[model samples]
Target: MSIPRDTRATVTEFLDRLAAGDPDRVAELFAEPVDWQLSWPDEGHPAIPWIRPRSTRAEVADHFRALAEHHVPERNATTVSAIVVEGGNAVLLGRIGQTARATGRSYTAMFALHLTVENGLITRYHIYEDSLSVAAALTAAPTG
Candidate 1:
C-alpha cells in the first residue's frame, strides 16, 4: 500500500537517523514514553516465545548504546532493503554485518522493525530477528 507523504517522510527520516547512529536524532523520532517490543524464537524450547514490553526513549537509547559499545562498527553500515507502510504503521527490513570489536568475531543477521507513529513521532516499535544467528555471532566458542 502507498504510504501517506508525511508518514513516509517521517519513517525515512527516523531510519536515516538510526542508520547514522545518532542517538539524539533517534530519540527525537520517538514520542515520549515510547513502547519498544523485541522478539525472537526461543533457543531451548518447543514454543516460539515472544519477548514483548514497553520502554521509554532513554531505555531504548541505553540498549542501543550497549550494542554500539560491543560492536564498534561503522555507523552507516546498516542496510535497509525495504519499507512497507500501512496506515499509521511501517515495517522496515534491514540487516547489519560487522565484526564485534570486543571479540573480533564476524556477525551477520537480518531484522524487521515494526513501528507505529502518531503525530510525526514513533509511539511503538517491535523488532524481530534471528535469535540463533545473533547468539552465534555474539558468543565466543567454548574453550575446553
Candidate 2:
C-alpha cells in the first residue's frame, strides 16, 4: 500500500529536484497561482534584476534564471544554518556566497527563507537577504 506524502516531505523532495538546476524540472513544483517575493530594501539593485515580486510560477522560475545569469557562484557549498518546518510552513536559515557579475567582487550574506507547500506544490515563497551588502559589492571597487 502506498501512503501519501506530507507537506514537509513534498517540500524536501521539490528542493532536492531543484538542486539539480533544471529550470523546467523545478517549474513543475509550483502551483499555477503562486505568491512569491524576495524581500529586500526598496532601493533594489538593477544589477541583480532577478529579485522582484512575483505572482506566478513562471516568475518564480525567472527569478532563478536571473540569479544564474547575474551571479557567478563560487564552488563553495552553501551553508544551511537552520531549518524549521511545521505542517505546510518552513523557514530556512542559510548563507550564500557569490561574485556579482557587474563588479566581480565576492558577496556573502545570510538569508532567511519562508516557504509554504500545500497538497504538493509551493504556494508561497518569501526570502529575505541582506540587500545593502549586495548593493555595496556591486558598487565598490574590487579588492586587491
Candidate 3:
C-alpha cells in the first residue's frame, strides 16, 4: 500500500534521527510507554547482550545505549529501502552496518521494522533481522 505523505515524512524523520545516534532525540519520536520488540528467540538472547524487548521510553534509550556500548555503528546513515503503510502501521525496510567492539568484526544485515504510529508518534516497534548473522558477530565480541 502507498504510504501517506505525512506518515512517510514522520517515519523518515524517525529513521534519520535514529541513524544520527542520539538516543534522547530518537526516544522523543516515540509515544509514552513505547512497545519495542526484537525478533530473536529466548535461547538466543544471551549471545546478543544489547538486544532485548523493551517496554518504556527510558528502556528504549537504554537499549540504544547498550548497542553503542557493544558495537561501533558503521551505518551512521542507514538507507530506507522501502516503506509500506497500513492504517496507522508502517513497515520499514533497511539495514544496519556495524563493527563488534570487542572483536572488531563487521556485522551487517538487512532488516525489517514494524511500527505503529499514531498522531505522528511511534507507539510500537518490532524489528526483524537475520539472527544467525547477528549472533555470529556478537559471539566474537567476547573472544576478540
Candidate 4:
C-alpha cells in the first residue's frame, strides 16, 4: 500500500534533515512532547550517553548531539533498505555502522524505526536496534 502524501513528505523531510546532521533541523520535524521510545533496558545504561528519555523538541536535538559526540563522524554510516508506510505511520528498516570514539571499536547493527506523523509533525519516534552490539562497541577496551 502507498503512503499518504503528507506522511511521506514528513518522513522524507526527516530523512533529509537527519542526513544533514543538523540536530535542530531534525528536531524541527517533530512535534513537542513526542512519544520517544528506544529498545533498551529501563536501568538506563550509562555506557551510551545518548540513551535517555526525550519529550520536547529541544531534548530531541540533544539526543542527536550526544550521539554525535560519542560516535566517530567519519566512520558512522546508516543505510535504509526499506520503508513501509500505513496511514500516519512509517517503519524504516536499515543497518547502522558506528565507531565508538573512546574505545575505537566499531559495530554494525540492524535497526527498525517506527514513526507516526500527525499534522505534518512526527508525534512518535520508536527505534528498535541491536543495543547489545552498540553497548559492546562503546564499552569494550581500546585495541592497540
Identify the leading candidate in terms of lDDT: 4
In the range 1-144, model 4's lDDT, one tens digit per residue, is: 122248888899889888888998888888888999999976658888788888999999999988899988999788999999899999999999989998999999999999999988899999999999999999999967
lDDT value, residue 139 of candidate 4 = 92
Candidate 1 TM-score over all chains jointly: 0.77
How far out, in Å, is residue 79 in model 2? 2.0
List TM-scores for all candidates, in order. Answer: 0.77, 0.83, 0.83, 0.94
Better of 1 and 4 by lDDT: 4
Would you give me the overall lDDT of model 4?
Answer: 0.90
| Span of 10 residues, lowest total lDDT, candidate 2 | 1-10
lDDT of candidate 2 over 65-89, digit per residue (tens): 7776666655434567877989888
lDDT of 3 by residue, 46-70 (tens): 8577676677778788878788888
- TM-score attained by model 4: 0.94
Q: Which stretches of candidate 2 lie over 4 Å from their true place?
A: 1-5, 41-43, 74-76, 141-144
Separate clash counts for every candidate: 0, 0, 0, 0
lDDT of each: 0.68, 0.72, 0.76, 0.90
Once superposed on the true structure, which residue ranges of model 4 sit more than 4 Å away at CA? Answer: 1-5
Off by over 4 Å in 1: 1-5, 40-54, 141-144
| Candidate 3 residue pairs that clash | none
